[model samples]
Target: MSTGAAADGGVHDFGCRGGDPAASAVSGRVSGTGEGKVRSLAWNQGTTLLRAWRAGVLPRRKKLLMTNTNAPSSAASLGLLVLRVVVGAIFAAHGAQKIFEYTIPGTIGSFADMGVPLAEIAAPVVAFVELIGGILLILGLLTRPVGIVLAIDMAVALILVHLPAGLWVGDGGYEFVAVLGVAALALALTGAGRFSVDGAVLRGRAPAWLS
Candidate 1:
């Protein structure tokens, strides 16, 4: 025969062929007393504890998961801001050198030497675009359109001046122009990010093209 203790502290016997009188008496006493009620109360308390633990732990886990996911996006916004500012500064410096230091006539002469078509007209136009666009880029004003214009300008310089020299900038190659062009293209596609004037002005309600 196998014997086991019940939740009510009663002993039960299995395989009692003759139906053991002692086991039957103990079962009747437990059922008639307050032990069964005490067991029910303990079971309810255990169930309540389990439910409370789940309620407390689940929200905490969800919050931790959300924090981990959001961290990378915050870092990306900062990265984009850094990229925009640095590239804008470089373009601005180059533009200032061409317009102020080199002089328009000198720039035209250089363009002519480089075999640029319509050097006289193209020289002033390129200089103006670079100077004004660079300033606008730094201010994050009209970012996407300005980025497109700068990208095209760099692409032209690459095709006409740098491509023939090869890939290394030290050898007068297209490396610098290619990098500038790709950066401009990226800006054109991504816009200025949350740190930009565009973001401040738009306030997350901008049109698709503007962004």
Candidate 2:
């Protein structure tokens, strides 16, 4: 015969199947209560504490929808993954227009109208940077350099053309362009993610150099 405590804290008797008295005794103490207690802890504090810890130690993990041992964190990577394709397609299309529909001088004239200096030279340079930089950004190759150039290009556009327009794009204002310029700068800083060519190239490299 074996004697034990039941779930409600009462005594229970088993007729001689007592393989191990110690194990049976422990199992009785909190078999049901232990699980209930655990549930209570989770409700009261465990889950929240776990979430807070994750927030503090690895904030980047919060943003990652997928996981890999190797990943990129900088804006350049995020921009490439998030903004590259859209920006690239638009830029390439515009470049095609400059190369085909509009002559360099014509584009330069437009820039001059927008108050850009050295419109003749700046026109072709801007077109090429957009055309090429867009492609590079989308490809996740040389993302930092490409993002920097694109950010600069947008900055110049904002200063020369949009600033005078005011805030609303509907009002021919600089507001929309200014927002885009800031986003571009953010991309320039972060670089492409782990899936990018930049990440592949920088793999096994020192983090200091990359930062």
Candidate 3:
């Protein structure tokens, strides 16, 4: 973390505007301190900013925005709640359809027809996992685990039943499962957000990976 200005030739005006007061003032002061440090000072409207870097580093105007460090906004939580409700309901409905409407025997027959391996074993597991996971998701409890399981469930459906049909859902393609998988994976990674039961209990006290 060395600190000093760059050499004269190192300074470049990034402001675009000609004769900018801040750029003009800093022009003459740019000079290397011979300690492998670089710094820049810019001022406008009686405000001053000084930044330093080492190891040939320089200031940057563009930065990656992949992370969100600020506290979750209420609107964001609301959005998460909506997403959870809708997606969870869909999953739960599918699960219920398998167990009640189709029945275990029927699901097994369908799985067998689709050439799914171990249809006898997988039928019940997939049904209960979706039902339980979907309920958990709706309640915002154990969301991450539920999300992962559901995502995997969707992935298996894609591979076994949907992928070979092409990209359109009308053709029985994987598009629907793919969307559900990504959505579930997103929930797994993001957790239930501030509107969830996890938020009410964890409150920053839970382990990072779990939270």
Candidate 4:
């Protein structure tokens, strides 16, 4: 005799009577028991296989499905986190030096000498963008908008300042500024990841404009 319990707490037993191995009878029923108790009892022997699959006892197929579904998002999140920190630190240091005279021009007059066009206007503006954008980028707050502005700022530098020198860093060319512009543009296109303040705000509620 073989026995089992059903989900609704009913008990079932299967047994053979007399000398017939093929001839089987259930005590309170027939070839089956449990009497409507086994709600998930699938109709065929193949049902056992299906149950095993639902329980994750089948590894090969499940693994393939999980891998294909989740891998790309994981990789992108990692890439975004890396880019955020590196870019932030680079901007912060450059801005600090300009703003505080820690390394370069103490004020607008020195910047004018460096041929930064209209230094009276451009110096403070550039310093504010670099300083404020760097801080926001590091905190991952308002990442998309900040990234957009920073990207534009870098693009302007590449066009107005660096392009005159050609392509090589040795030639004071567009190489560095162009690369920075692209990085900021990429961040603008994709918001910060789950580890960011921007992500927290996004999860709470959709921004008004997003609706």
Candidate 5:
């Protein structure tokens, strides 16, 4: 079984598949920052730590060899899968409401009322971005770019519609949009996990970056 940690200092994973991964983890003693505390993740084993093996590095398992992480970390992939589905669902629903319920013209009217410049352009752009980008995010296709776009969309909404009310959602404040924006931004930075289409195609290959 693989393991992962949340943003908190504590580690989390699927409970008890067969063996005691926790015991093995303790024996290994949380090498480097995988101990948690949410720092920058190294794409591969630190070169400094692997210096001795540089001359004759032997291949391990196929997936492990392909991915950035040095060890199996299925739990983190699962966490990312969960995040993508939930956030994408919310985005898709809102997009559907704007497209079907409000209709493009009605959405344009709303945008005009809100004093958004170029409502004719902004309305459809926002609508399709939410709908198409949400679907892409759910499928984990082109995840990094989609995440970045969605984050910008929400940022615009937060600044234009919600910020005046302050932080409380009850007051039609920025809290909700802020959360959505930050979540999308996080995905942009991290990319979808190994369960994604990006992972399948890219396979952590020649370019160390770009999900």
Candidate 6:
């Protein structure tokens, strides 16, 4: 007798003794005696599968899934909130120094000494913009507009006072102002994120333009 196995591990015995050839081929086993056909249909099927795989007729498949962690997750929103508060605080402190510690007149004199144009008008306006804009940024109220204004203010500072000094803040260069401007521009583009007044009020209903 001969034996064969199916792909599922089932075995069939083909007794090669005293059996009708037609019956053995159709029933996959011998009749009237233990003898059966020389080959099993299961073995042929398995070989066909292997040949197909080898020939690339039945290639294996792989599955993949992708996710964007930076696209406004909860943690990302928290980070944005932290950035807003820190940058806002720094701006507010600078504004306070100019408006109170130095006094508006003294700040204007200082700007004029630095060769800043329209020192009298620009000094007071920059002071108030920094103070009020910083507060709004920290609170995440009207964040986009406030951020845009603050960015513009930093750009003016860079052009008027810091550009000529080069990149180092210690040498009165534009590096610090440039960084602040970039941060403000980021806020304007990304909005205040989830932990903000806008987020709370909108409750996931915010339009694309707003957040």
lDDT of 5 by residue, 1-211 (tens): 6566768776655334465767655545554446443344342446544763564444454456676655326888888888988898889888988999999999999999987889999999999999998888888888888999999999999888889899999998999989989988888887788788777786556253456
RMSD per candidate (Å) reads 9.6, 10.9, 12.1, 13.0, 20.0, 11.9
**Candidate 1 structure quality by residue, lDDT tens digits, 1-211:** 6677889796766434467867766766776577779988999999987887777975787889997764336567677688788888888888888899999999999999999999999998999888888887787777898899999999999999989999999998999988888998898888877677886796457774565
Error of 4 at 18 (Å): 60
Candidate 1 off by > 4 Å: 1-72, 203-206
Runs of candidate 5 exceeding 4 Å displacement: 1-72, 204-209
Scored by Cα lDDT, where does model 1 land? Answer: 0.83
lDDT (tens digit, per residue) of candidate 4 on 13-63: 444454343453334554245645464455554788888888888887888
TM per model? Answer: 0.64, 0.58, 0.67, 0.60, 0.66, 0.64
**Which candidate, 2 or 6, would have the higher lDDT against the true structure?**
6
Candidate 5 lDDT (Cα, whole model)? 0.80
TM-score of model number 2:
0.58
TM-score of 4: 0.60
lDDT scores in order: 0.83, 0.71, 0.78, 0.73, 0.80, 0.83
Ordered list by lDDT, greatest first: 6, 1, 5, 3, 4, 2
The model with the greater lDDT, 2 or 5, is 5
What is the C-alpha lDDT profile of model 2 across 1-211, one tens digit per residue?
Answer: 6677779797755433556666655666667689799899878797787788777744566546454433555654555577766766666777768766797888988888877898889999988888887787677777666777777888888787877778889978877656656655666676666667767776456352242
Best model per lDDT: 6
Ten residues in sequence with the least summed lDDT for candidate 4: 18-27
Error of 1 at 210 (Å): 2.3
Stretches of model 6 off by over 4 angstroms after superposition: 1-71, 202-211
Off by over 4 Å in 4: 1-72, 102-107, 204-211
